[model samples]
Target: MADNTAINIENIYKKYNALLEGHFLLSSGNHTKFYLQSAKVLEYPQIAQKLALSLAALIKEHSIEVECVCSPALGGILAGYELARALGVRFIFTERVNSEMMLRRGFQVTKGEKVLICEDIITTGGSALESAQCVAQQEAKIVAFAGLANRGFCKAILPNNQKGNEGSKIQAQSPICKLPLSLPLFALANFSFDIYPADSCPLCKDSIAYKPGSRN
Candidate 1:
């Protein structure tokens, strides 16, 4: 993939029918004009392999040494495993046990191990951060974060901020993301969609918000 990966991402998403356009109720409780169902694209093993190799190339180009790939559970498992295969590294994952990220199933990371957090999509970076925190608890060094798609949300504030009302928590991804004005969010492509609060959402006015995610 080239430096500008968004075009390639768009092409792949379209090819795999991973991109959906409509009034969507996101997992975050916000609304958006578009949704990226990455599972559609990754469902094919051959397709997933190709995408992971592309991401591995990007990681090599950056000279970042990743000893292993760790992903947040459920969604990130396939991508992370494929990426680890491409990178020739070990793989492990963190899952939500009681809504908190935990390394169960006898998974363990060694101290000072260089780790890369992988995800299918990164929107708020909260889940990725939680997984990273899990790695940190093992004294593992978080090299960086990689995702198949980055929703490109680094800065901006909303009254419905799910994490907290902490005003400046958005800019922390600065050092982490190579995308324009985003952090730690290395992705195969970037996506930016207009999200809205419920009261101000135009879809809510039309009474046609559709929940299109598997979790729902």
Candidate 2:
């Protein structure tokens, strides 16, 4: 993996500016001025390879002995595959089954395997935790986690530790913590929650055009 500190996240944003958009509802359910479309980078094999190399370098810096790299289905799969390739380790993904993420199709995390969870984004950390829980169910240890961008959100929740209250408040725990490539031009904190609901929202009442955005 390449060194995250050395990789200019700002440069990444500049390269892929055409793909990003405004007024988006993130997976974390927060509306922000900036959106990171990881797919745009992943769609380009060269960019993906560069990111994977950077992530692999970070893993090496941390001295995390990961035997395999596990990622949640859909978004994290490609990045995880690239990371595993860079590290020369096996790669697997867990898909959502009835709302609960699980490994299927004969995929299994053998007991005692040192697993590292990878994800495209780190909003809310929900999917990453699901992947971690699935691996833990097989009695494997999670060596560390890696993400392309950490969006400066406080309180990232982990899997299987929802009941506990320790270390839950701390935000951003990626081995390779890269600041968002683009900074938020505007702060939405001033906006009221009623302004952004699906319907009957205050913004709607105020005639503010609703902008629909998605990850894909």
Candidate 3:
């Protein structure tokens, strides 16, 4: 039988050696000692299903309605597809063409259609935000964001802006992710690591930092 128990995402990464401790570059143009290569754990279909199912359960607990799941292409495709399958919702992805994220392949979102953005891992949620923009351009409503793991720059559940309107921005923050604070981010676990910008990266003083994940 399939294991339906709660999963410890960190442990899974450890088991697969997906968690690495070293100076590395992130897609967000930040440097960190630790890197989570979710592909290592997700390469196994069974494990991917289990993880996706758990994420789906978390989303449903919030009573959030989603008609579709959209993920940034390349890194998020597997996790997104698995999540969509678990949620019984359709899945589509956005790809970068000429340095801009576009929704190609004849995919379409109806006006105000509810969508949930999924990612394998969210560092500063840059890619996810780009995907959200694509959905927003289609006039679809982004209900929430989900990821397998969070880098802990932001909390899993964002604060309430009950008095705010649709175009309101996150208050009291410099906007690392650029995602609105009103939209909650759901993740299985929070992986807290020290992140530094390229200019001030301490690791760059001696060791060379390499871009590990897909994205410039």
Candidate 4:
């Protein structure tokens, strides 16, 4: 497969019917008309590998040194594993234990080891940041963050933020993202959808919003 562009990424999502349109609830407690159901596309291992390989190419291009890749379960496991396979790095995941992201199953990051936090789809980056903090607590060096798709909330962290072609596609950063602004974010595509707060959600007035995400 060729290196993926935003168009290619969008096409893949559409092909798999992963790009959903409806009044949906997000893990961030926000409401959006569209949602990128990455599991649909990731269900096919071959397609997952292609996406991961393309994403790995981007990290390699930046020469980002990553000793291991950590993702927050359960949404990110497939993408994270495939990415680790492509990059030839170790892969581990953090799960919510008492609502706290923790590395269990003997998965621990070594001090000073370069780590990359990944997700299948990055919206406000809350989950990814939580996993990053878990690594940081262990004194690991977080080299970067990545996802299969960016929801355009943290466009400021995009490495090519200044490039007219790519930058223009993403809007200015919103306050929703909790990730540090200093770290770079790599994603295959940007999906900018209209998100609304619960009180202001227009969809809520007419129909009940559905929570279609993995998190509670």
- Which tens-of-lDDT digit does each residue in 76-192 have in candidate 4? 999999999999999999999999889999999899999999999999999999999999999999999999988888863333422443532345667888877777788877777
What global local distance difference test value does model 2 have? 0.62
Best by TM-score: 4
Work out how many backbone clashes candidate 1 has.
5
Question: What lDDT is obtained when candidate 4 is compared to the true structure?
Answer: 0.85
Query: Which segments of model 3 are wrong by more than 4 Å?
Result: 1-5, 158-175
Among residues 3 or more apart in sequence or in different chains, the pairs in candidate 3 whose N, CA or C atoms overlap within 3 Å are none
lDDT per residue (tens digit) for residues 15-112 in model 2: 87623544555554445445666777788898888778876765675466889999888888888898899899999999887778899988888899
lDDT of 4 at 78: 95
The TM-score that candidate 4 achieves is: 0.92
Off by over 4 Å in 1: 1-7, 155-183
lDDT tens digits by residue: candidate 3, 1-216: 223355778789999999998899888888999999988998999999998988887777678899999999889999999999999999999999998999999998999999999999987888999999999999999999999987766547421221231212222334576666788787777777889989999999989998778774
Off-target runs (Cα >4 Å) in candidate 4 are: 5-7, 156-171
User: How many clashes does the backbone of model 3 have?
Assistant: 0
User: Which order, best to worst by TM-score?
Assistant: 4, 3, 1, 2
lDDT for predicted candidate 1 compared with the true structure: 0.75
Worst 10 residues of 2 by lDDT: 183-192
Candidates' TM-scores?
A: 0.80, 0.71, 0.89, 0.92
lDDT, candidate 2, residue 114?
91
The TM-score of candidate 3 is 0.89
Candidates' C-alpha lDDT:
0.75, 0.62, 0.83, 0.85
Residues 1-216, model 1: lDDT tens digits: 422332367778898888998899866677888988888988999888888887787777667799989998878899999999999999999998777889999999999999999988877676778898998999999887888876767542212212332332433443333333332445665577778766689877767788876456
